[model samples]
Target: MQPPDLLFLGFFAFCAGLIDSVVGGGGLIQIPALFNALPNALPATIFGTNKIAAISGTLSAAWSYVRRVKLPWALIIPAMLAAFVMSFTGAAIVSLIPKSIMQPVVFVLLIVMAIYTFHKKEFGLLHTHLVVGRREKLLGVLSGGAIGLYDGVFGPGTGSFLIFLFIRLFSFDFLHASAASKLVNVATNAAALLYFVPTGHVLWQIALIMAVCNIMGSLTGTRLALKHGAGFVRVLFLVLLIGLIGKMGWGMLR
Candidate 1:
């Protein structure tokens, strides 16, 4: 890749990490940037390379949040385990699924998420702890599996979906929900890597550079989210949702 391409991707990786640290749609920015920069590359190679950077940023953000915030591990661990297993399953079968089919589905989901979040002003403001039981654990496992599968297959708005599910289903505030999402996301990323790395699809040179930038961005975003609180995260989440909607909608149209 040329110097300009490196710079362009680095910039987008940083932006992706920043957004991802807060809400979880970093792929919406990073994936397209990868496709644009390496137009001739295999899609698997691009997705593999993306996981390298994404895992780095997500791990960084997860650590940052772990230090500053207390996460509900009881719920998170099960979700992470489910995400890891199902993510691998999804990656294994990704080739069978067509991108065209996933695009419209995700586009519509983004619109609904945006509308719901916008309509409910107090959606993620207050954190309510769910009494851990069969139902709560079941919900967590199911959501994690479904979203993990999606992340493994398409993977633009995985983080956003995780956060929203945490907030809506588990009664977590935006801050806590974001923190929880990072753990599940890490599992999904790792699971995908298990498939990608063994298949020799990753571009380490480009991925490392993007990873550094992504980590820096993730740290910055984590600090801001921790300092600003749930309201800020909620607003950022909505912004990212809108962006995801527009990006996917435009791609479908063209």
Candidate 2:
């Protein structure tokens, strides 16, 4: 095991916490830092460590959002539970595949996601509902469960995917979609960590410290999102999506 690089790791965790709090792409900051700081560490350990900090930030942001916004529990509760279950299953299969395959796929998806968000002139943040029926529930479960599986297996842009699925499928405003995104994301992260922790992969001391910082960052981020509202979040979401694409693509290429 590599000795932890406290300084770089802590700083990266703090930045990740803040970004994750805002729009849900914290791995863009944390994962690379871990790789650079502990280049010799096993991939699973690094991923497990990353989850330790990330889930902390996500849960904090989730609670903050729940307190501030009227969460649609009727829809989100089952979604979260379903997501958690699926994430565990995905984690079970993660090591069987190489990440190289996702590179081109994620890159193209990112470009399309950005363009779609841009071209749809008058879209999102309107809290409109174009979906109704069993289809809406299926969309949530299918998308949520599928993405939850993806989160545990790959984990680059799960948040953006969730937001996009909600916006396109449910026609929800960006704010509400983000709020829902947090709940499901927390579940997936937690579920993955459950498998990781028992395997003795997590760095507990660092995870605890990072968790504290993550919660603080989450508080600040949630407040900012609330103050700025949906349009601002939509923009930030796009930016994070790009970062995720770049980071994942670069990692795959190298």
Candidate 3:
């Protein structure tokens, strides 16, 4: 049956796109929108629909950033590949393991990440790009794998974690970190999609509606980012990080 919520998919998609383009946490808005709107729908179907909408927004944001900013192809390509592979593995094991096991650990990590970002104040304001040797490359690959696994499993704060890693470990600023995070997010989603699509979980019709809305949201967010620059993105990033803590932590407790 066609999704009853398909009627306003376009609006949801546009909003997702815009929020994702700006700070990378559009899921905070879009995913809930899907669940609340599709309460009677299957959980897997909702997840699939969320992925479709997320992909649309992510691509739109990635394109928007690429057009306005210079991206680091060296790190982005390998990182994305690694994340994609890891996500696939994680998705494969989704039913085998209880993801609840890692919830508390991830929650602590998010707390640290958010606190560090908040205290640093000038952590990633300018383009820095620190690591150059094998250490740097190793960090990228390892980080990608770690975050990808998380994305495939839980998936709330992937963007925030990614941005923080790029900034702290790689010496990139907020804007640059965000640019790279988009590419990685895309890869992780693609990996999850591969597994999800086969299981017949995706509601393509509803997903399409959300995708369109996500796209619009992404475009608007990109424009705002371009206009306001790094500082504005930083503020939103911190806000989202805080929100993530509450969201994930609550989910774990409940």
Candidate 4:
């Protein structure tokens, strides 16, 4: 790629990291940007290269959140493990499934999520006490597995879904939910990379430059979330859901 193309993609990578760190729909930005910039590249190569940048930003955000937020380790640990395994499985089977099948389903789900969150004004505002038990752990694992599978197969809003699930299932506020989602995302992205890397799909030069830009953006976003707290994240979450809805709905229509 030329310098101009690298700069163009770097700009998008930074934006993706910023939005993704706060809410989890960064792929909605990064993936399309990849496809647009590298129009001649194989789809798998684009996805693999994107993962390199994504995982870098996600890891930075996850570490930042770990320092600032009080996460539920009991829930997150199982979820992370489950996400890793299931994401790997999803990546392996990705080619077997068609993207058309998943687009409308995600579109409808995003709509419902947006509507419910909009009506519930106090939703994701305050963290509830988590009671860790077998049932709760099972729920965590299942959620991780399901979302991870989706991420590996056709990831656009993995972070948004993870945050919503954390808030809805575990009664976590947006801030904590965002923080927790980062760790699970790290696992899922890493799992995808395991497949992509071995298959020689990554474009390392582009990915490395994008990773630097993404890390910078992720750190900036993490600082903002830690400063502003849950109410800020709640608003951004709703906004991201709308964006994801639009993206998915448009894809379905196309």
lDDT leader: 4
Which parts of model 1 are misplaced by more than 4 Å? Answer: none
Of 1 and 3, the candidate ahead on TM-score is 1
lDDT of 3: 0.81
For each candidate in turn, the TM-score is 0.96, 0.91, 0.92, 0.97
Residue lDDT tens for model 4, 93-185 = 988989878887888888999999999999999999898999999999999999999988888888989999999999999999999999999
Q: Residues 1-254, candidate 3, lDDT per residue (tens digit)?
A: 35555655566667667767767777877778778787898888878889988988898889888887886676777789899998888877777767667777778988898888788888888886454567766778899998898887777788888988888888887888888899899999998888779899988766776777778788888888888888998998888878888988788678
Candidate ranking (TM-score, best to worst)? 4, 1, 3, 2
Show pairs that collide, candidate 4.
none
Model 2 / residue 61 / CA error / Å? 0.3
Rank by lDDT, highest first.
4, 1, 3, 2
List the global CA lDDT of all models: 0.92, 0.80, 0.81, 0.93
Better of 2 and 4 by TM-score: 4
**Residue lDDT tens for model 1, 98-152:** 9988988888888999999999999999998678888888888999999989987
Candidate 4's C-alpha runs over 4 A off are none
**Number of clashes found in candidate 2:** 0
